[model samples]
Target: MSDTMSETNRMTETETERQEGYIPHAKQVDFSSFDEEMLRKTFPNSVATDVSLCAEGVLMTARSKSNDPQVTFNISDMYRAAGYKQTATGSCVPFAPEDVKTIVLKIKGSTSGLLEFFYATGSLTTATADCSVTGSYIGGEDWWYVMLDLSRQRNGQYTERFNNGCRIDWSTDVQKGDTFILGEMLFFSNRSEGKAYADSRNKIASTTIGKTGYGDDMPAEGVEAGYYVCLYQNKLGSDAAGVSATFGTTGLEDAISFCNSRKQLGYRVSDEKGNVVYAPYTLLQCDILREAKYVTTYARENHFTYGDAPINPAINNRAKKVSCDRLVCWVMYRVGFTDQPFTQGVVVSAMHTWSEENGFIEITDKNDLQPGDIILVKPNGSGTYALHTFLFAGAARQKGMYFRYDHGSDTRIMSHQPNVQELELPGAPFWRAYRPVATATNNIYYDRYYAD
Candidate 1:
């Protein structure tokens, strides 16, 4: 046999592959930018229930079956989107187990059994060709949480066994055809004997079936309470997955009323006039006022801003809002901030400044400020010397807080700040921050990237 054939056989027999064992030539050919839209078209596994382009990288959610809902996705698709391709004969991306430090799955599954998640790590040698599966238990029910970080591995391969699973991985390759397969959030069941169907109790409660899912109709506690009202509910019935709902009279009425009430609080409410209205700043404050917590500290301790035109920048930006503001608002509103701006600036920024030099302070500049850092401010006031500051908490509402609070209405809570001019600097900062937060949702403007 030739010398090359002999060397390959020896290495395979001994599992002695080194990092420099195979030096593949780097191609010099240029190609179009990695197009996620295009990359998704290549594989059956590309479709995801949710897809998000984040600071760390692209994140996607797909459905599968196992002990519960299992999620899987591929690094290969990301690589292709990043402009890499798989060689014709190659298995695709050749990844060492150590390269991946974290793997997470936001799961929803049956409670009876543990959920198993799998990943396809194309191997460099035939002896190591095997899939890796990771398992976890979400107890029971359709719940969600971050999964394991199997960065630690034995050898250059990783493997786990379970009844069923799905996974998401980042591949090292960027070429077409040669890509890793990925999936996310799959449902797994305890009974491995056959498919697990929803029990009779799994059906949407008959009381909730036709009634509006939000407002007083929903439970005060638990997963089923509150409405995620969608303005387009009437337009897109069952087909609508994100926000659209099917209930008619009550559903439509509740949605409209909620939006209209919040319209005064810088929250955007779409109208037939082809004009978008903004809520007022006071409304944001009042939202917190209503949700006042006894622990008050935690609830408002890390509060932030929620508009395009914040009082300042740095502390009052978008990232902070999504990670903090919006989440808190959703939680408190669910807990009982039924009034306008249900969870507005005050409550949103409540936790901002607890000490002497604290309160919501807008930064005239963002580039100079670091995230999670506090924002300080000194607003002009009639008092001797006004120096109040709120933590530069963060931005919660993107699309720059819109509501009926026109400056003309001095009593208005949520107010409309012009998208351009006057609040430009502060508003501009909010838009940049909102870009990433808005991308998290596959809502109405799903096709459009973040916009002011």
Candidate 2:
């Protein structure tokens, strides 16, 4: 055990056996500054469906059964590219569950014994996946709300790993043109804290299905109408998990001819480290992905400019038009950081104001970054004239490292692959990192921290 942030997840029982908890020396050793060639050789191209890096000698791989479709996947050095083969493995993303106290999924369908869902620890394939089935029932005519408590032990399965992600396993009963809509799924942290919310649904018609220890309140008036256009439909000829089909919303259908759209491979992210980096919280990360998809398809539909802010995303829900900074802010607000500086907010004195006055602390050392921390960006040589901001997905560099993001590249959302140390930061070329210190406010994600 070292003072490194990994202490939280890497501390071993052996260290505890000594009675004196051990923490290794703490020093900021910039690995990117190390010989780039040697670093590459040391970290050769390897693949894991769920990959996590530790500073010391431990390279952890979360495994699941690997009965993958016969399609071959082209793996590469970027590493993340390996996780992109949804067609082959049937990935239904936007299924990030970054740990939450509870997961509530509501669905409507035609038939049921149990609203069975397939969940795996690794890729849906047989090699690494830890697959299992859970049972739920239809409440009213065809609706069911499944709530799960992660705080208490579940299934009594003596395993330490938590499920990464899950999606509905469409049954043979499902036929083309049949209606199967997944209403809103809610992921909330501090589940025991939300018992009052559960009580509110006591007499509600929608909760009749929730008699299962997990809260099941589904008042018709309370439950928002299902987004019919957005609901999942069993299109003809697309029964294979990774098979494709096309459907589109009316708004875009008219704008872009609601042309054919394919199905999500339905791969949900799983968190094996107990890092709370998957599920409920991952759902927020999906917001970033969803918004990015919107921008990719409709960037032309939006107008971009600095100084202008998108309407409160909680209400407007999407950035109609936005500058790079506004896109970051819109996402922060929508991810449940309802406090200002983000929600219903605007840029303040460039990025520093938010990092300083608001609760975010700018990181002086890149190694200190945890997931959800943000790195600031500006045009080359554009000192203090900070032009952009995006969520930090992970670190990939040793010196001033190359990090990744599913966010704004320039003005439009794209993949993140920037070196913080390489970016221009006014004085020297040092990168600036800022993140809200972990704290709970009326907002749930008030101070989000990745697994330490």
The top-ranked prediction according to TM-score is 2
Per-residue accuracy of model 2 over 129-164 as CA lDDT, tens digit each:
333333333222434444444444333442322233
Backbone collisions counted per model: 80, 48
Candidate 1 local lDDT, 1-452, one digit each (tens): 12233433344323323333221221111112223574353222432234433322233333322112223434444334433444232312223233344333333322212233345433211111235533322222342332332433344543322111224332211112221112232112111110112121121100111222212323223123323222222212243312222111123233344343332221222222212222222322323222222112232334433332232222233333332233333323322222223223323334232211222233336444322223333333432222322222223223432211111122211211211122223312221111111222323332431234
Off by over 4 Å in 1: 1-44, 48-166, 171-346, 349-362, 374-452
Q: What is the C-alpha RMSD of each candidate to the true structure, in Å?
A: 21.4, 23.1
Candidate 2 runs further than 4 Å off: 1-307, 310-319, 341-344, 348-350, 379-385, 396-403, 406-411, 414-431, 445-452
Question: Which candidate achieves the best lDDT against the true structure?
Answer: 2
Cα lDDT computed for each candidate against the true fold: 0.27, 0.34
Report the poorest 10 consecutive residues by lDDT, candidate 1.
Answer: 189-198
User: On a 0 to 1 TM-score scale, where does candidate 1 land against the true structure?
Assistant: 0.20
**Candidate 1: residue 293 lDDT (0-100):** 20
